[model samples]
Target: MTHHLAPAPLLALTLPSEDVLYAALLARDPAFDGRAYVGVTSTGIFCRLTCPARKPLRANCRFFSSPADCLAAGFRACLRCHPLAPEAAADPCIAALTSALEADPARRWREADVAGLGFDPSTVRRSFRRQFGMTFLEMARQRRLREGMATLAAGGRVIEAQFDAGFDSPAAFRAAFARLLGAAPAEMKGALLQADWIDTPIGPMIAVADKRSLHLLEFADRKALPAELARLRKMAGGIGLGRPQPIDQMADELGAFFAGTSARFDTPLALHGSAFTRAVWEILRQIPPGTTRSYGDIARDMGCPEAARAVARANGANQIALVIPCHRVIGADGALTGYGGGLWRKQRLIELERGYALRHDRQPDDIGQRADGGEAGQP
Candidate 1:
């Protein structure tokens, strides 16, 4: 049988060729699980390759490989079959624990404490670090620091902010903030800076945007953020560091979003990524908040279906989270796959959209605080 190597143009994004699709399927890689799909255009229905549903003939079945592809081809998401949800959960225990930690960043979490939560300390430690690139305890500490920053921005006294943030002492809080943001609490005041706090279902997110665009969006204490901001400072010639205002406009819109009142992200964005990664990020923005597509679908839409793995890699490289709408992309089986913001966040984001009539794009740099700190896991 001749294998079709070209991607079907009906999808929103590109996808891999038939040979590559079959290989990914045969290998049962959970990574590519939701990025591809097979459509029996003859039957006017599409199904995930991993779908337990009966398999159709390879010839009669046209492979669209992405939810957008299937939709573009005039096929609707199967009501009896959902292909947007990922089949396999990526490290479920770690995901749950991370969600718990984010929810309660004020609570001190020790390895022994985590062990008492019915998870193996070593496994939990390795899983969180591998998935998020930071230890659970480290994430907690960062969260406390972010809370301190937010509190200070809200006009609270240093001591009040420090204690409320769960800091052991004023000195410790100041040191931690200085180490991470290069400014002491008192030094962070003044200037045209404005600050505000917004809460998502997962946790609180902080956004700093100027009048024209958003500069940073992040959870309260995400680990990657302090470093990212340092980079932004160098890029902007040290303009919006400890001082705010540059990111004020974005903060308002972000607040509306998490409040379940709005989903439109009109703020201009500064995305830092390679050309291919940039393209993927752009497509991610086009995905509506409530809707979803797969990475394979994105690849096909980009006219490079055979580059599904490469597309997935680019998705992983995406920095801005919800604003870019990367979370809307699911595995082939309609399951949540990789999300740097954590699957729990992804799930809650979906739920929030649904509850509020669901509308949803790329988060700007440092888009929100992590509530807890560290690298966002893969998208």
Candidate 2:
């Protein structure tokens, strides 16, 4: 007698060919843990492949290699799976410390404080750095600063902001603020260049601008941000905090870009670079939103085939972020290269651009900043 086999699940028919990641997502496969992540477009959240939460559909799934990649695609971390935890808490020390951090995010953490928790400070540091690319202390400090910025943005006094940040000294608080933002809380008066936080789908960006032109824009968490802001302060005039007209304008354009409503960054940019770099950037802006170009291609376009390396350098040097569109450049072999914002963000930008309705292709329109400000477009 012939044996009868069970029918395959109907879901298998809907999956992309050779879709191993989605299969792993459905299976709650431990093999893909830390090796794969899934972003649920419908829920706007990402999860580990082993996440036990009810699975999303194939149509809504976007797989990524890491949490950073999911974040760049505007997906928030799955609180249930704790996908953002370093190594998903492979180390017991990391698990405990991160749990404590989640419980008390504003707690002022010190090396001694970490030691007090019965963890070897050095071990904890190494574990966190190896897993998260940052020490536990640094992560704690950034959390505190996020809280502090919330206080300041809501029109609270500087001392109130400092207190909220859990800083022991007002001076130390001001110094940290200056280190991150290139200006003390008190010095945010009417300086020539004003800075404000513009929330995008990927991250919070600090946009520094004058009345009519944007000068500097970079992700707040970028490693080079403080130094870039310092240089901008030196080259331009005093750097202050508060939304200038240009900052307001940039915030709106960013809103449109992320919404896929428009890819036209028409806000006047005050490009700061050598003439060659400036020329390279102009070529960058001309590349259509949905298309990418190689650095070598850009060099060839500039009539300097030998300048491909220089073009790559200029692409890395661009501080204006999306406005200058440096993320559009790729390697000669069609590989995505380093973006100042992170490779995850570069991938997301490319993914996002593919959906954009280019401004040149559509009728002109004005989009205004929301009166309700604070971390807009956060998913």
Reference-based TM-score of each model? 0.55, 0.62
* Ten contiguous residues with the weakest lDDT in model 1: 370-379
Instruction: Please give, for residues 212-267, the per-residue lDDT of candidate 2 as tens digits.
Output: 88898998777888889888888876787667788888888788888877766777
* Highest lDDT against the true fold, candidate: 2
Write model 1 residue lDDT over 284-327, tens digit each, in one string.
76554455677777888888889888988887765556777777
Report the alpha-carbon TM-score of model 1 versus the true structure: 0.55
Worst 10 residues of 2 by lDDT: 368-377
lDDT score for candidate 1 against the true structure: 0.60
What lDDT would each prediction earn against the true structure? 0.60, 0.71
* Residue pairs with backbone atoms closer than 3 Å in model 2 (clashes): none
Give the per-residue Cα lDDT of candidate 1 at 114: 81
Query: Distance (Å) between predicted and true CA of 269, model 1?
Result: 6.1
